[model samples]
Target chain A: MAEMVFQRTKGLQDRPFHYCPGCTHGIIHRLVAEVLEELGVLDKAIGVAPVGCSVFAYDYFNCDMQEAAHGRAPAVATGIKRVHPDKVVFTYQGDGDLASIGTAEIVHAAMRGEKITTIFVNNAIYGMTGGQMAPTTLVGQKATTSPFGRDKNHAGSPIRMSEMLATLEGPAYIERVTVTTPAHIRKAKKAIRKAFEAQIEGKGFTMIEVLSTCPTNWGMSPVEALRWLEENMIPYYPLGVYKASEEVK
Target chain B: MAKVLMKGNEAIGAAAIKAGCKFFFGYPITPQSELPEYMAREMPKAGATFLQAESEVAAINMVYGAAGAGARVMTSSSSPGISLKQEGISYIAGAELPCVIVNIIRGGPGLGGIQPAQSDYFQATKGGGHGDYKMVVLAPASVQELTDLLMEGFDIADQYRNPVMIIGDGMLGQMMEPVELREPKKRNLPPKDWATTGTGGRGHTNVINSLFIDPAECEKHNLKLKAKFDEMEKNEKKYEIYNCDNPDIIVAAYGTTSRIVKTAIDKCKDEGINVGLIRPISLWPFPYEVFEEYADRAKAFLSVEMSLGQMVEDVKLGVNGKKPVYFYGRTGGMVPVPDDIVAEIKKILGGAK
Candidate 1:
């Protein structure tokens, strides 16, 4: 008999993913849950879901969860991590929840050196709010709100969250990875493990920015979305390690 | 527990510590800055946590996070800063997390003056944010009352699993008074079994949320919240009466204005006029029963406040049109003195505005 492998990760619940058919949030969530399960921190992980497409993450993640208001998940994660310093804490947020309204929250939380992990999914569009223009949307990209292409003169260019956040001295590790291909998905899982490892070692403020594809919001097929992500999103958001603290480095 | 002479802002800090608040998140704002400063200096020494957040929006969300994790937490700010916090407040209220908030109100419609004012009365008692929610609004009339109310405020928050606010003014915050701090009491309270503490070995994920997309679900949530508000109205009505045994006129006021109104009532008594006073301690509960007792017998009602009569609306509603209600107020950080209130009461009784 052939040995069996690749069983379902016990870190996630049996509930089906509620994301759009071709969106990569389900893939990203699987990577995170698999990493926590492999690290033996599944039951001890406290996840904070932001007010965007992944807002119902509490039902999907098989752990204690708290849903935060839009853009406020970092601050909420800070509060939770502060009270239980020994527990593993993470926040799953999208572009609109992190870069636009919660800019202050994410920046200040990073500056304070809060001991927690952040899984930032950048799809470059507001998937939960009817595909509105996001702060991470490419300059030429058209959104529901930006019916015409995004004008850099008026809307500004896409914000490089990992690059910008790495400039702060508080974070222990900061990396931007992609999940467009199988090789990239494996690398993305490795980055997610390193983020949680930093927290396990008591390193402060670790974050991983996963460049994901939103097929429904991007108005592309699954294959087209993956190709577009590699072609368009990767150039603006180059995938690599942006920052690593002295101990982690 | 010595009767030390301390500022009201400092007293509030001591009260919160006595109430077992293990964490504090706040930002600097006028008049109330001293309160956060007090927490910063004292919380660390007590082996607790203090974080000066980037903004009021960040501060309140920080409180939301801490409270969701089952820790007793608090935050403080002034008028403008509190306005910036309404978004987080609505979420915290909707999530049913227990916490304490302090609003050292000043004059305002936009960055109003830093002096004491009761202008935030409506904002505190009525819905300050965009929601159908309520907070147990506690208005303290003195520095001692500030300490007493906060001791009860933290418990009130924990008991109801809701947010409770102590809205004072710049005078109470800046003034110094003798206060004998209450010793810490381990009250018999229910455990926070529903908090998200990483689930432990419970084998069940505890979720803290308020979002319900379906209209029927949202309406059901609204009904559940409304029932809690109704319970608060039943059990939390609080007010104090001064010389109401038999009165021809009643003066309605709270916070700093209540002190001045008390003097005006005394002056009226000396002048052989039957003028009593009603000070609503729980502003949301409104203490309307006090008005029901005197509305039938009193000749009229006078609502005096430091703002342009914000609390007057509640006073009229409490009176329920049984007697003609009069309002005399000063705005823009101006306080009406005892003589001014007495003059207004006399003119009103004399059938004048």
Candidate 2:
């Protein structure tokens, strides 16, 4: 008899993903799902899906979910977590949903030290909206909205969200990770697991900013997208533990 | 509890807590700030959660979250603040979530004044948010009525799986009146089986969402929502006919304006002028049946409001050209006096009395 070495996590539904070819969202979603299943909280978890590319995440997560309006997931999660403190609540958001239109919600959620986990997928471009320039869009990167290759003077430099959020006193854990290789995938999963564990332990806000790739929007092949993200995004984002409180450890 | 003198805003907080509301998310806005302050002080004692959100936009979204989680929740704001909440309200309505919203109306087109006004009548009754939806709007005439409406508002929302708006003027929110926080009569509320409460191994995931990518699916959802609204129009229309017994002239008013109209009707009675009032408590359903019933007997319909003739349109629609419709109003934070309403009533009567 052949032994099965790997299986899909029960935290995720069996539905096929709608993400574009070479998009890193699938890997990130799988990592989050695997962490939830490993943490043994799949049945008690509620995920808030954002209005960007992952708007359909509700159909992908096996647990109960809510689809929030544009830029309102943090506030929505805050509401859920405040009422059901024992339930595991997390928000999966994109760069435009988190760093741009929803800036105030994310900042204030951290300011309140809300006991919720956030999976911030920083793809540096808007995917669902047909590749518009995002707040995390790197300097000199071309987007449909920024046709002039993201002029530094006209559009501000990319926002380093994890580093910025780590400065706030509310967060117990904050990290920046990527999934460009098998080794990186394992590390990203570890970061996601730690964030969820911190949330379950009643720590303050925990967030893992996943530096992802959008191959279709970036006008690159999937392999080239990974190389581009490694050379461009990783240099600016710097994959590491930005902040981790002693209590979280 | 026995009847106690309470401020209108504080009474709302007490009534909501008594109604088993588990959460409140609000922002400080004039004429409605006291309610949030009261909740902030009282919610913890009742084992409920109260949060002062960064903005009205955030507060309403928070209400959406709690409501989707199958928790009774609410938010409150005045006119301008309510404007900020319209986006979230539209989403909540589209998603068919149960929550209560209180709007202590002040003057507005933009940042008008802190004084009481009925300018938001159209915004409340009409869809302020960008969507084809309806909210069961209750326009309470006094502090006691405000208390009563909120006590039952949560149940009304849950029963229909829709948002409920309790609207009052700044005067109604600030005035002190004797109110008994009565235990609401039991209602047959539908179970919140659709709430996103972690499934608990329920064999299927319950998603709280309003996004329908397919146009056909979206249309179907819209029709389903319309059916619920039609049910509300049929079953939830509430109004009080005062001195409407074979009246010579009829007056239509709601919320704080209705109280002034009532006083005007009494003054008209002293002069041997038979005047009647059709006070609509449910503003969205508009109590059109009462207007239709009184149209043949009443010579004219006077729509009294604090704004420049908003509800008059609804009155005209209800009267259906059978009786001449006239509007009397004060604007920009001005409250109408009984004498002014009386004068308008006499003017519309054409000195026949």
Candidate 3:
């Protein structure tokens, strides 16, 4: 008999991901699931799925789930959290869903210091809507909507959500992380764990901003997308904890 | 409970509490603001959650969330605010979630005014949100009826796994009347086994969603929804007949306008003019049967409304050309006086001869 060195996270359903080739959403999803199972809240967890690429996250997560309308996951999560305060409620959202159309919901959820966790996946472009420009899209990046390469004057610069949310008094912990390499994946998972831990401690709102890659949408090979994210995305969205409430610390 | 004098808006809140509703999410909108304010003050004492959402859109979504979690939840707004909530309402209807919505109607077409109006008849009875869906719209004419319908609204919503709307104009929301806060009749509600509470090691995960990627599956879902609506039509259609015997003309109205029509019917009686009233309690599964029954006996059907005649189309549909259907209305925050309704009734009667 061969001893197994690794196994799939029990938090995820026994099914293959439908993500595009080289898309890092699978990895991020696995990391979040692993953390939830490791935290031993898998049975007590309820996840809210957004309207973007991960809309079928309800099918992926092993625990109970809800699919929210575009950009309304935070509000949905808030409702579930309020109904069952002891239950672990979280929302999985993409950049276009969180930073653009749902900006008001996200900001107000943070402002209210809701006792919920949010895993915001920032690929810098809209993945599900056939690669439209997202609020977090880099200024010079090209998208179907911004055909002329994002114009700094016309479209504004990429928004740094972790930095913006850090300024609010509601959040207990806010961090920006990526999964470009083995070392980075470890750090990203740790950040996700910390965010959920802070939420479990009843500290306040906690969000982990995962800088992800959309290789097909970016018109790059998976390898090149990783390299591009490290070189360009990292410089703009620095990897570190933007805020950590004293109580959580 | 004995009858107590209560504002219509507060009575609605109290009625919700009596009906086992545990959650309320709403935004402040005129003529309906008191409902949320009352909830905010009283829900905490009842171990219920009350959240003032940032917007009507957010409020309705919050209601959606709670409803999906298997809680009896609600939200309230006026015409304009209800307009903003259409998207969430559509989503709730599509998802087959149970919740209640209260619309204290004010004038509209865009912030039209704060005064009472029935201009939202089409939006409410028809689909306001983009979808092939139906909400059981209850038109309550007085504070007591508003209270009674609101309590029953929750049961109706849960019974059908659909949103139930209780609509009243500003006058019904703002006025004070004696209401008995009776314990609602018990219902054998289905177990919320589909709710998105954590599975707790249940064999399978529960997902609350409305998206059907396959058109074939989507069509089947639509058919399923239509079946629910058909059931609602068969069982939930409600109306009241006031002096609806063989008469010169039949008056069709609902909500605040119906109260005025009643007064007009009384005044017309003094002049020896036999007038009848058909007050529709449920606006969506409208009282068409009543119209079909009296179409030949009544010389004409006069549809009086606070809007420029939205419900008249439904009246015509019910009458089916057997008798003429005439429309009389006052719009833009204007209320029709009983005397005016009486004059219109006489005019229609005189014209028939």
Model 3's C-alpha root-mean-square deviation from the true structure amounts to 0.9
How does candidate 1 fare on TM-score? 0.98
- List TM-scores for all candidates, in order: 0.98, 0.98, 0.99
lDDT of each: 0.90, 0.92, 0.92
lDDT for each residue of candidate 2 in A54-134, tens digit (9 for 90 to 100): 999999998989999999999999988987899999999999999999999999998788999999999999999999999
Tens digit per residue, CA lDDT, model 3, A92-150: 99999999989989998998999999999999999998999999999889999999899
Candidate 1 or 2, higher TM-score?
Answer: 2
TM-score of chain B of each: 0.97, 0.98, 0.99
Residue-level lDDT of model 1, residues A1-249, one tens digit each, is: 988877778888999888889899989999999999999998788999999999999989988899998999988998898888989999999989999999999999899888899999999999988999999999989999898989999999899999999999999999999998899999999999999999889988999999998899899999999999999999999999999999999
Model 1 CAPRI quality: high
Model 1 global lDDT (CA atoms, 0 to 1): 0.90
- lDDT for each residue of candidate 2 in B87-191, tens digit (9 for 90 to 100): 999999999999999999998789999998989988988999998999999999988888888988898899999999999877888899999987667889989
What does the lDDT read for residue A231 in candidate 3?
95
Task: Estimate the overall C-alpha local distance difference test score of candidate 3.
Answer: 0.92
